[model samples]
Target: MVGVMDDNRLYAIGEVARRTGLSVSAIRFYSDEGVVPPVEVTAGGHRLYDVHAIARLEFVSTLRELDAGLEDIRRLLAGGLTLTELATAHLSRLDDQVRRIRSRQAVLRTIARQHTEAEQVVLLHKLAGMSDEDRDRLMDDFWSEISEGLQVSPDFLGLMRNGPLVLPDEPSAEQLEAWIELADLLRNADFRREVREALRETFSGPGAAMMTSSKMVAAFERGGVIMGRAQEAQRAGTPADSPLGREIADAYTAYLGEIAETPDSPAFREKLAADVLDIERLHLESLEEYKTSTDPYTRYQSLVAIIDGSARQAAEFMPFAWLSAALKASVSP
Candidate 1:
């Protein structure tokens, strides 16, 4: 049976505890702490609580259940803080706690999936602790190191400055894994050397110099026209040996010849093919390695574009490779 409420009612400590579902000792403790001080003391030394005191103790119980600190509860009782203000502050703290818990859960999930050793677990935790700024700086440092002394254009430098491996604020398991692999790749001496070599190959040579020259911009525009035609042909399923394919191939070969400062001859075509093929091999190898480190299903389109456009110009040369092979074969003695 519930205790009856009355404005003038005064209850013994035990009776108050029974009504409020708080332990008698808890009520006494709160009274002693002046959190919910008793209204009076009986002649027998028993604490007696009035209706107001009972209500205050009940409110304190609710706050304690909500994990409110003792000092905060005391401040509220002392009229130093409003309940609304304290609740809002506590809610914010709870939200922060929830975010921290979720982050830990995400890190633990990653560790479990990886079946990491102790050392690896420690490293993963360290990686997870990195702030967004830290990650961005790390990526920038990697790019700066590889690009040291390279004659990159402003446009190209901008593309490289904004790198591909951006981890989301709340990253998924796969994204975290990608980040881990990417970090390893960035730290790799061999990978750095490979990137440096690719940069040199990309920005050097007569062809590279021609591409950068303002005088040769018109030449590049002409080459773009040929590339557009080749793409159309490719979409139309035209074979590389077809007359249309041969025409596009010839136009492409002439463009390369002009860039390389060579006459349009079978010998020059062969030499150009050799140079491009080597760089193409290196680019393909690097792309494959990067692909292995990331989620294949989730493409990093921007990063891919940067790598293809700046490092290899794979988009430009993939069709060119097919065309070059056909042109070389046709001009063979």
Candidate 2:
């Protein structure tokens, strides 16, 4: 035990070691490094620490174990590291390190389970670098590029313009597989041509453009109204065939027919029909291509299947169908 003098100065190095759980040599080394200078020396020439020095020494040991450099620890002990700025910088660095470690861990787990090759490591790294938004943007650009020059309706274009991919933060193996497959498919020229052709079909007829736009709007609005009414009807126990219900239904059907027709012109109509057939064939070809391609990554197959099912259903049941019926009812004897 280093002696404690009567003036209340902290005793020699041994006392600091017992209190800080650091070795006496470590305390002396830090002092020599100017990390935590000793407060004073005794008559026998033993180094002594004040209460403040002892506390600072303990802080040095803690910081060092956390991978802080000795220089940084020295700055901290010397009161040069302003709490706000220095801490903020360190915290950011720590967060980045943590994320990198986690990403590596995830890749290692994949390799262990799947026995993947070197190429898989590169792929995993690429994926780790991609944010959800970035991934979606890549897919959107791919679809838009391939689908260009096809006369798709504004509604379909709008749908495409909105992100088509839906990868979650913690994506599943299936989802990751789907993303890779989708990316590969987007690069295929034949696939692109097919998608373009199919999309052109809806824009082939006279007034096709006008019809598509109007139908899209009418369908969306009518659907919302129908849902509200359906809820009300369900609550009131009223049959959906009531006068109010029929009016809503009829209006919806009529709108559909209005968009599907153009001002009469037999020659133009014939040309339009031909264009439509070509577009349909092209689009169908793309789908056929998908069928023949190596089974898409599971993620992509699931994503496309879900998106396609919902989209096709919406197109078929668009409220414009009801509008068409209303227009027909008004004209009949």
Candidate 3:
């Protein structure tokens, strides 16, 4: 039997466990796996480890705490890999885990705020899983459905095709909610029908598909002049029935006359007033309904689309309720 206190000063498994703060079984397992093997064995079969083995076992404990796999740790202890290389690879894995955890946290925060039912939760999770291209395709599909057969300019069509309400990567709670609301709005059958009907009316109206790029520019320039005059009159507190209001109405009437291919006369002014009121009614019934709906996200989208379309087509002529009122007050007997 070897002497208990040898010249090399080896420790038994119990002493190694006590010194390293590792369990006795863990020390035995590592010793048996040749990870931190004992230097010598006593005649009674006691495993006696060299002092250097304690340092190796302690290192293994640290790597285990860092979530290094047992096989990798075994390989590391077998001198097949460098510590720096293992640390760098483990760091990369940790970074990926962190990203996944953060993504899950963002989703949880979004779901928490929604107070959503089971199906809605599932739907939101599905949306969260979508890539940016997938989300864009979803929005494109909705726009295509509504814009089909509409005689809109290419620029206007592009604007509609890329409407706002894009989902951000790693979106915040509010952005996620906005995406959900926008998706719901797109899925609504009634809203789709309303948009399609509104487009049909717009394409069939007086200033309809006749707006080429040049015509659109001219109309916007003319409309800008009229709007500037109206703004000045408004700032000066001109009454809707004032002669200045009549002048602005006359300018708009001339603009419409150009569009409708009619002479700018009192008769045409009266006819234009009727058409403006009809357009106002249709606007109120369709896009304005979405603008004032409960969903603020969809509401903003609707308002942006309406304003953008009006600006593109220069169809801003007296189509508003207040503008219709002003024109009636100016042109009435």
Candidate 4:
């Protein structure tokens, strides 16, 4: 029952508690904290709240149940804050928490699968938290280092530089694992050296001079056309020593000569045939490394494929094989 003094009605602490479902002690504490101060106090120091104060206490109790801080409730009660602002802040906090939780899940999954050390776990956490820009920058630095003083084809170098693991807003365990492995591989000094040497031996050596020439762009375009013809011939199962095969081979050799800035000759054909054979050997060795050796470049490629959905079928080497045979058959017996 409301107490009456001078024809004004007010609620005692116990009465407000009973109505609002807050404890008498909680109402008293809220009053003490000025979050819901009482409207009156008697000579006996008993607290009493008016209808407006009791309503304020009810609202404060509701806010408390919703996890609002006392200071925030104070501001809200004092009309210095709006519900929209509070909701936005809480939503932002929830989004951050969700991201952190997902990252933790990914890291734990990685750790469980790998049975890594504590330091490794720490590193995993850092990797999971990396921003997209930071991730791209890390890969960019890696590509820059490996491509330094190296005349890599623009299209090929662009592929290397542009390939970055795009972690989802909530990354899956597998995605995160792939990203971690790829990042570690990219940062590896030995892996960098391995790639640099391999690129030089495989790509930079055979066509290095042609790529450096002023007409290299035109040469590459012309080579593409020549290679396209060779690929078509191979696809049709044309015999390497057939007239059509020889005709395409003549054009292919001519394009190579133009790129090499030399005339087509018997000596050039023989040397190039042997050089192409050596290239095949190098390619086989590299493939074997991917299959059997501890070298992680293959792992790097696989991880990138996972991240970017570029994990298509393996490159068809039949074209190279056909071209090699055609090059050999074009030589005078």
TM agreement with the true structure for every prediction? 0.54, 0.51, 0.49, 0.52
Q: What local lDDT does model 1 show for residue 12?
A: 89
lDDT of 4 at 288: 54
> What is candidate 1's lDDT per residue for 1-333, written digit by digit as tens?
975788787888888988999999999899888888889998999998888899889999999999998899999888899999899999989876765565566568767777777877776666656676877777777778777887755445554454444454445444555455455556667767777777777787666654555555566568768867866776677776788866876777778777777788777766765665675577577667655544321123324343224323454445555655656665754
> For residues 134-174, what per-residue lDDT tens digits would candidate 4 score against the true structure?
89888888778777877755665664454565776765556
* Candidates 3 and 4, the one with greater lDDT: 4
- Cα lDDT, all candidates: 0.69, 0.59, 0.67, 0.73
Better of 2 and 3 by TM-score: 2
Q: What order do you get sorting by lDDT, best first? A: 4, 1, 3, 2
User: In candidate 3, which residue ranges exceed 4 Å CA deviation?
Assistant: 1-8, 146-333
Residue 223 deviation, candidate 1, in Å? 22
Ten contiguous residues with the weakest lDDT in model 1: 295-304
Candidate 4: clashing pairs of residues: none
Q: Which candidate leads the pack in lDDT? A: 4
Model 4 residue 203 lDDT? Answer: 59
**CA displacement after TM-score superposition, residue 270 of candidate 4 (Å):** 41
lDDT of 3: 0.67
After TM-score superposition, the amount by which residue 222's alpha carbon in candidate 3 deviates from its true location, in angstroms, is: 23
lDDT per residue as tens, model 2, 21-70: 89998988988888888899778879988887886787778877766778
What global local distance difference test value does model 2 have?
A: 0.59
Candidate 1 is scored at a TM of 0.54
For 78-165, candidate 3 gives per-residue lDDT tens digits of 8888888898988888876764565556557766776767777776666655666786777777778887887777665664454544
